[model samples]
Target: MAVQASPQTLAPFLIEPRFVPRVWGFDDLRPWFDWSRFEKGREAGDPLGEVWLTGDDCHIATGPYSGKILADVIAQEPRAILGPVAPRVESPLLIKVIFAREKLSVQVHPDDKLAQKYGDPRGKTECWYALDSQPDAQVAAGLKPGVTMDQVRAGIQNGTLEDSLNVLPVERGDMIFVDAGTVHAIWPGSILLETQQNCALTYRMYDYGRPRELHIEKSLEATRLTTRAGKVLPVSRPDRTILVDVEYFRVERLPVRSQRSSASLAASDEPGPGLSYLFAAAGSARLTGEGFEPIEIPARGLVCVPAVGSAFVLEDLGGLDLVRMSPRWPAAI
Candidate 1:
């Protein structure tokens, strides 16, 4: 049973990352994350592939909400965690660090309309920020120009779906957007920071004889011949780099070589909502503010700040490269 007591005393705090095992993952997630920092048995005898930063199962690592499930905290203080003008949703964003040693299944994600038709909250539309990549690293997004649905079906059946994929080379610091309804796949040689809608409704089109269930019918129905899925150019500023400002999320990259206010340290704070995520992509950072215990974010670690919560200051313990992520709602909703 979970404690239902009010955790209003909670301030901006660290979020424990959840490591999920995958067939195509690496045995060790190094340089980026300290595998020992995570609890045991998470690997499950398989190579770990993903580190979910803001997942619902992720527990609060500090302050009043320490040891509480992320979902429970949000449910108890929706307005405080989701902001005053944000949508009424369980989770605003699912931030993850993907470590793929091989290739993921050729998949497609349903859009909002298709997802809602199947009694789901919303669909997935993700953007990837490449943190590290080897030479010739690649990802497949959408289909080759002039490729038809019939060809896709035939390719999947004949096990040649890769031929129809529109492959893109990945480089460090690149931003790639994958919209809903676009068939996509993640390949090896790159470390990715993925920001997406909270929903995880993936429709796998094809897997390389991996014994995984394939969602052929749903994937076909969700596939689109053309989508706005490709490399997105980022705008660089003196203090931060604006990565993506899509309908569901806003992401920014900040360089903190010294101390700064949480307002200036993070993105989309101050005159707006209170919810935000500060990810230490490179070095270490320490967060301090009134009414809350100070918390430190190590390399590849994530921290969450609630809406209207306590104000804080981010001090750079080393070469801190932070990625600030937050949510935005659509007008029609």
Candidate 2:
């Protein structure tokens, strides 16, 4: 039997959003996503903490590729879709919008070495871009300057692990890069855009008396006792800013100003030659390429741009704020 190939297009395709419920979730997800669009018939108190924008299971919402899973599309057209930097057949980066109403568990993730040893595919190194924050909102990242492994263990045993953490206040537009093996937690009243390696192997160290299981031995083995902190730095460029450049992925903030035409917007910057996830953070825009029909990307929506040589443009309606995330083969320090 002659097998047929799935259709391919260089144009961007929208991805359906997946809401994940959590115990520490918040009911409201605004500016980032309008929960009312998808949760119309649901109950009022279904607190959703994370909105998975891009995953293997995320399906295409429109165009000829509608209803097709992202993983399948990648598998069917690996070279055409993934371009020259196709790390694997599957997408290497995971994008999500996290809303924390209450404190998350103090956890640590293994590095690549430990992940491989523990029979996991990959480790998690995540970066957070704060979209919104309430007054006094804070996040605990890394251990205190002088905290040692012995102290960490003692604090965990004595229910004082938080005391050994360095908590810092956060606000909108702040960026934080969390390296693998760093002990961290996201405090209450925060909405963040998180980009991480495609892995979910979390080793919980402490959960603040929650009933969930704790991985003391495993977390301790993965935890780095040395002092580490994520600095809140401003991005250099307004048109396109490289927010995070690490081994796993590279996240850039691209603000498409209100342009007259697609040609003018495309002239703003050169699109990289690889698979990139385009997330509409604020306003709506029209995604147009050479031959494919234009696609509308509403606020809080996500679109996948295939690896094509021809650049695409986002015709900004008002002001379109987008975050572009792509996988990097070798770690870019």
User: Which residue pairs in candidate 2 collide?
Assistant: 247-331
TM-score top scorer: 1
Q: Model 2: what TM-score?
A: 0.88
lDDT by residue for model 2 over 79-155, one digit each (tens)?
Answer: 66777545466677789989887899999988888999988877888889887788888998898888989988988
lDDT score of model 1?
Answer: 0.85
- Candidate 1 Cα misplacement greater than 4 A, ranges: 1-10, 40-44, 265-271
Q: What is the lDDT of every predicted structure here?
A: 0.85, 0.76
Model 2 stretches with alpha carbons more than 4 Å out: 1-9, 28-32, 39-46, 227-229, 260-272, 331-333
